[model samples]
Structures are given as C-alpha cells and as structure tokens.
Target: MMLLLMLIADLLILSVHGWIVYKTTKIECFPNARYIRNATCGIKAVNRYRSHTNMESDIVNKLRNVSLNLQIFLRNSANKFKPFLVNVTANLCSILDKRNFPAYTTIVMNILKEVSNVNHSCPFTHPLSTHQQKRLIVKNLYMDEKFMPIVPPLGLYKIDFNFLEGYPYDDVGTVILYIQVTDVKEFKLRTKAPKFVYSTIIYKTLSIECKYNPEILTNVTCQLKPINWQKSVCIWDADIPHSLKNISIHLQLFKIYGANNFLPFLINTTLNMCDVLSKRSFSVYGKILFTILKETSNINHQCPHEEHLSLYNLYVDARLVPVTLPLGIYKAVVRFLEGYPQVFIGTTVLNLEAMEKRERRGKVNKN
Candidate 1:
C-alpha cells in the first residue's frame, strides 16, 4: 500500500508542475488584463498622431495661400515710387524634431528699423497662422536695417517667408500691407511780365502739384495758396476803371521801366501816328513833351529832368527819356499834340521811383 501511494503522489506532483508552466505560457500568448490595457493605450496614441498630422497639413495649406496673396500685393504696387526692390527672407524651423513642425505654430511677423545700429522693434503684429497643436514653440529672427527705406510712397508691401534659404515656398508663408498715402495740389496767380503792374492786364496761369505722395494719382486736394497779394498777378483792384477817362484816345502808355536803377526811365507810348501819317504820306508833324517832379521838392536842379520825346518814324511811335535822379518818390507828366502850337490832348503820370521803393522794401523784409 505504501509503494502504490508513492507512485500516485509522484504523478500528481508532475502534473501540477506542467499545469503551472502551461498557465504562464497561455497568459503570455493570449490576451490578459495587462495586454488589454496596453492595446487600449496604443490605440489612443495612434489617434492622437493622426489628429496632429491633419493639423500640420492644414497649416501647410494656409501658408501656401499666404504666399499667393503676397505675390498679388507686390504686383499691384510695382509701379509705385520705390527706389529699389526690398526683399527679406527667413527660415521657419519645426519645433518638434521627431516630426517636421513649426516651433511657433502661430506665425507672427513684425516690421522694424534700426537707429544707429540698434534695432527698434515695431508695434504692429502680423498673424500668419492660427492653428493650434500639441506643442508650441518660437524662434527669433533678425532683420537687416538696409531694407528699412525700400518702401514706396504709396502701394502695397509684402514680406516673404522662405523655407529654402532665399527660395519661396507655400509651406513657409508670407505677410502683406496695403498702404495709400495722401495727395494734394496748389495754384497761384502770376504775371507774364518781369515786374507786376496794376495797370497791366497780361497774366500767367500758375499751377503747382504736391510731391508728398507720388504713387497715388487720384483725389488730389488743393491746399496751398498765395501768401502775398502784392507779389501775385491778380492784385489789381477790380473796381478801378478799365479805361483811363482823361487819357488821349490816340496815345496809350504801353510801358515804363528803367535800367535796374542805373539808367533813366524809358516811357514808351503807342500812338496812331502810323494811321495819322498814312494819309500825310511823306512826313508826320508831332511833338511829345514830358516833365519830372520830386515829392520832397528835393529836385536835383542840375539833373536834366525835362525833355522832349524821341519820334521813331519807322514804327510810328514815341518815347520819353528822363535823366537819372536821387532815389526818392518822383512822377512824370506827358503831353501829346499835332499842330505847331502843340494842342494838349492828354497827359499821364508815372510813379516809377515809388514802385521801385516798395519793391526794395519787400525784398529786404523777405530776406
């Protein structure tokens, strides 16, 4: 009975040992509680990765669109007053090394200028992308100061984001700014003659355009005006009679001037001597007399202040030449007649010295 019991115990012990080994192998081969947990975690990780990939794909698409818009802006503003083309480029590195992704998924652009080699950051913030991701990162970019003055007076500007050094790509992206400067114009009255005179009717049209914004051509405003009426051509009084009532119908005072304060006044008068002597045929008989007087009775008696006009028979005209006098207010009296006795038909007064003094004062004040 003891030998039979020992054989049975040995068989039971071997079966138990084999059964433990089988159970451990079955736990490893088939799904257990720990295997189920690991599978569930793996599924979640795969879904997260898919979602991240989709987000990156979207960002890349949007950046491409940005590049297109930038090109359009540059094309439209190409004709503007830009001295030269300003080109800037930078690299947008991926923050995640495992996958090529932007460190700062949210792209921001800023324009800046430097002062004495020191960079002064701009206040404007340009948003290039708005996609959100699992990780956020940022990179610092340095802008060269040489590009600061390349902007045109009016037109759109574009900032290019290059992924491959200086080459442009849709994945890297771009920024744009549409700037329109103001326009203006100005007008003033002027004279055709070297010196303006109230009696003269000759005028010249003066138009001035503002140069502040040369790029914008439409909607210009006239903001400038003549500051001094005396310096303008339209300073003559409108109420003054167009025709001098007492002046002779045959003789008209065409012009009165001097050799820039060095010579005597040359008073030119237009007369119908040509028409009058056209009938006379051979010779025209007429005499013109003129006299000069000073305001302060400070006449230089030695000066030849009185003279008879010279008759230019070729043109049927006459002129009065008065000797030069001291710088002061003065006037000239002119008379025209036809007969030997000299009939006084008309007379004119010239204030050349007075006008000269006024002009001199104006220049002094201007200086």
Candidate 2:
C-alpha cells in the first residue's frame, strides 16, 4: 500500500513537471495551444519518470508465478488425503483335544499395498463360544511375527493352533462351527468359511439279546457311558415274559438314530435270530424287538441297530429270572416270546431314522 501511494505521488509529480515543461517552453514556442490531454512526452522518459525501479511490472509477474506455485502445492497435499487401507480376516476355532495344537495362528495376507499402511490382524476367537464353553483363553498370539512389527505383513504367521482345520471332530457332537477367514471386506459364498460343527452320526449303539420271564422282567437303569472308547450300541433279549404289560413297558426304551441304514438289517437279523433261538419247553417262546436311543453324542464309531437284540427261554426257574437278567429298566429288553408270561405283541424300529436323516440333511442344506 505504501508503495502504491508513493507511485501515485511520483506520477502526480511527473505530470506536473511535464505540464510545466510544456507550459513554460514547448507551448510558448507553439502558441495555438493543446490541452493537458493532448500534451505528451517520450515513452521511455515518461515511464522512467513515473515509477520506482524496484516496484516494476517484472515484480507483478513474479507474484503471479508465486501464486501458481502455491496452487500446485495445495493440490499435491489433497492427494495425500485419499483413504487409509486395512485388511481383515475371519476367525473360528473349536478344539476337540486340548493337547492338539492349531496349524496356523494367522493367515497369509495376500493384499497388495501402495501409498498407505496395511494392517493384517491376528485371528481373534469369538467371545460367545469362549464364554459358553468357559474353556481356556487362547494364548501365544502374535502382532507381526513374534508379535514384532518388523515382520513383513504380507505373509502368513504360525497360529500354533489355527482352528480352521480340514479334519473336524466334535466334542459333545451337537453342533460344530467352522470359520473361514477372508482378506476382503465383503463375505464370499465360495470361500470355505470356518465352522465347528457336528457331523451327523452315521451310526449309534451296538445290540445283543437276552431272554427272560415277563413276570420277572426287571430293568436296572444304568448310565451308558463310553469307558476307554468302547461302545455299547444295543442289547436284545426275549427270554421269558411275566405280564404282557412288563414286556411292553420294559421294551419301550432302546431307541436308534438314522434308522434308514441299520433298522431293516436289525429287524431281519433279530427275527431270524429269535426263530432259531431254542426255547426251554413249557416256557413261552417269545421275543420283543427294539431300537436303542443314545444321542448323547461325540466323535466315535458306533454301529446301528434296530433295537435291543434279545433271547427268550421259558420253563426255567421262575425265581432265577430276576437274579439272572433281573429287570426294572435294564438297557436291554425282551419283547416277544410266544406262549411265555405275556402274550407276544410286535413293534420294530425298522424306519426310525429314515425321516430324521432326511430332515437333518434338509436343515443343513447338504445338497
């Protein structure tokens, strides 16, 4: 502003001097007289007379160049503000054996990075399962590699016990869930996600038959727990009948799962087995067929059976019947032995599991 004012003052001074020069001499020399508008001087002499040397038009051009430079600088700064990038993967782990360790603690991040930082997070266990199971807190996790930031972010790190195992084993066998980790933000259908789930039991409980008196039929409720990995599918016995009521009530148990596979064979085998079963004369020859029920599941191989496989003998010491296979609610049952204590009635689990298998497959969307 001060320079502008000075330039104005200087222009005024130059105009007055030019006016004086013209008025005092040049106009006097030529008397027909032009006005101030008409008065003129040499261009170089006029410009030199009006301006300070330092505040020349060259300076204005330099100021314009500075403005252009500032604009370019601002544009480059805006480019840096685009977007920050981070990559995330999924986590799902279920353990059958505590001693067995996971394969990978972290997955290999495949995403490429350029301008910004890429964050690949370690697998985090889900809060619900941990709380539900009240199991061990997952340990030995890492940040970069030894959890150090120095390790490269692109590669995979050892999880020591990654739960995305291809081989699945269900502990209690209700449901197994597997979680599939993914690098992208959107979930993929094709990607095999992680889940821990119970594979449907292809078979359950083994069966054998024992026959006893219907009047003395007794069952002792015993917990069928697997000891040392041994399995007890089912047991069938149609020895002697007490009252028809005892056979019906006692035989009610012994259920089976997925009946489509083994029920027919069991029924066929039990019927044939009973036909040949020699009965002690005077004791009603009878048999009751049943399928066992043991859904309290785990990852183990138990053969399928239609029902308790049983044998029936009549005309024996009636008192010994209670002592021999003494029954209140034994795991095994004797359903039909004709001419025995109770008249033989017929029921079989030939198709008990067929409907169940179809329903479960539909539920899982196995197709």
Candidate 3:
C-alpha cells in the first residue's frame, strides 16, 4: 500500500508542473522534455517585460536614422503619431482596429524596447546642444476637425522645429528637433558613444506654470534641465497635461492612411484658428504645406470651380494646385485653421471628388 501511494504522489506532482509550465510559456510542452525545453523558453515568456538599456552613441545614431526616415514617410501618410512604441508585452493598440496586425505588433514591440533603452541615454546636457536633437516627449496635445485624438501612426511624432544656432545647423540658424521615449516607467536617461567613451545625458527642464490651458501652450520657454531618464516617458517625471476642451498645439501627430486623404486635410485653418481660439499659425516648424486637387475638374481637388476653391475652401499652402496636379501622390498640410472649433475643420463637408492619381508625381515637391 505504501509503495502504491508513492507512485500516485509522483504522478500528481508531474501533472501540476506541466500545467504551470504551459501557462508560463504558451508553447506546448514536449514529451519527456516538459521540464527541459519549457524552462529555457519559459524564462523568456516570464520576462516579457525584460529589456536592456543601450546608450552607446553608435547604436543610438543608427536608431535615429531609422526614426528620421520613418517620420518623413509617416507625415505624407497621416497627421500624427506617438514616437517610439514602448510597453512590451502589452498590446499597444486595439486589435479590432483595421490597422492592427500580428507581424507589425511583434516588430514594433521589439523596436520599442530597443529605442527606449537607447533614448534613456540622451548624452547632451543642452536640448539645443551640438549634435544633440532636442527630444520632444510631451503629453500629446492636438485635436482634429472631428475633435478626435490626433495620435500619429507607426508611432512617428513630429517635433516641428527648425535648427537653432551654435548647433549643427548654425549656418542656417535653423534648429532641427527630434525626440525618443523609454520603455520602463522611471526618470533616468542614459547614452553611449563611439571611441569607447561613456557619457551621461542631462537636461534642465521647464515646468507647466499653469495647467488651466493645456492646449493653448504659448510664450513659454523650455530650458532643458539636465535629466536622468527612468523607464517612464516623461522627463524629471514632469507630468504631461491633457486637453480639456478643444485646444491648439503645435506638436500635432495623426495616423497616416493612404486610403483616406480627406482625413488629413485642414480646411480654412487660419480663420478657424483666429476665430475659434484668438490664435494664429504659430508653428516655427515651417508653414502648413498641403497638396490640393479639384473636385469638378476630374482631378483631386478642394472643389470643382474657382469660386469655391479660391473664395471659401482653398489649400492654405500656396504651392498646392488649389487648381490641379499632374495626377500623382501629393501632400496637403494646411497652415492654420482660423475659425477653428466653431467652424467645420476639414474639406469633408464639401463632398469633393477624387482624382486619385497613382503616378503623376514620384515624390512631393520639397520646395
């Protein structure tokens, strides 16, 4: 009886262990190898939150290059997006959304981990410092014509800045801006460089003096505070403000979708801004540039005729045809919408037709 009882006990223990391994690691346990194979893989599953910090300058530069091209591509597609996608193990977005995909999910989650660690090592003490791109990791603050969140796609966010002097672009006195977010939720940042050299990244920061106007951020100055990065996205744990009502912000990001051109259009933006918020286009990033096509002319457009296109709804960017293009992919970045909230925000209301040219232009005219 004692021998029989021992065998039963051993079998029960083995069954429980197998169950534990299954949940910890979703992969199936192999016969006679449950304890062996599963344990190795199980560690990875258990440590989904696991990430390594990479501050090495060379690695950081490689990441930045990838980021730059991503932003430009994204801009032509949508209006806004988050910068680096962090928070591994968590589904960053809704699975039900059409944009969601399994492959993209895996690829981005890994990039999030890699870039977050690298950015945490921001080397330069000054945001305007040489070879240093001022990181723009602010609480998201923009609303679309529908008053929807303008979160950008592919996690690409725009800093919307010109290079400042004493920096790389000193000759032009224009400041080029870029930003990176970390994975873990803390306040210290780190960086590594070539030449086997190590350096600490620091920044002196400004505070949100008043929270009353989250969207109406203006006339305030951000002196970079020497900061240590934590896994948390904010610097010095400085809390980011959220929009209460409709707000006006320069750093705007929206998802880019090739199928939806109207969604990107910002209509009567100057008057809308002035009338709605008593503000004008304040983006130092450059004027709002957009590509326009005509609705009636069998070409992509704001409207069919001159009266409607010129008088009421015209592409604010002087370069846009507001008349016609050669029938190819183009962009439309409306400078400022004046009578904003009170009035309609996009060209949607006009019910324009599409020229939807495929090969008219190979690339956007950068001029």
Q: Per-residue lDDT for 62-162 in model 3, tens only? A: 11111111111113345554322111111222221223433233333333332232223212124234443322111111111122111122222233212
By lDDT: ranked, best first: 3, 1, 2
For candidate 1, the TM-score is: 0.16
- Candidate 3 or 2, higher lDDT: 3
Over 225-319, each residue of candidate 2 has an lDDT whose tens digit, in order, gives 22222223332243223322222222222223254221101011112222222221111112211111112211012222222334222112222
What's the TM-score of every candidate structure? 0.16, 0.16, 0.20
The candidate with the higher TM-score, 1 or 3, is 3
lDDT of 2 at 64: 8
Q: Which ten residues in a row have the lowest lDDT in candidate 2?
A: 64-73
Please provide, for model 1 over 1-367, each residue's C-alpha lDDT reduced to its tens digit, 9 standing for 90 to 100: 0111111111111101101100000000111221011110000112210110000112122121111111112324346432112222223222111122121111221211111110112111123434332111121112222222111222232232222212343222211222222111111122232321222111111322222122212233322234342222111111111211222212222222363332222222333332322232111122222111111122213222222221111110112221112233333434433333434433333332322213334345644
C-alpha lDDT of residue 193 in model 1: 22
Deviation of model 2 at 148, angstroms:
59
The ten-residue window of minimal lDDT in model 1 covers 19-28
Q: Give per-residue lDDT, candidate 3, residue 234.
A: 14
Candidate 2 vs candidate 3, TM-score winner: 3
The CA lDDT at 296 in model 2 is 22
* Candidate models: Cα lDDT each: 0.21, 0.20, 0.21
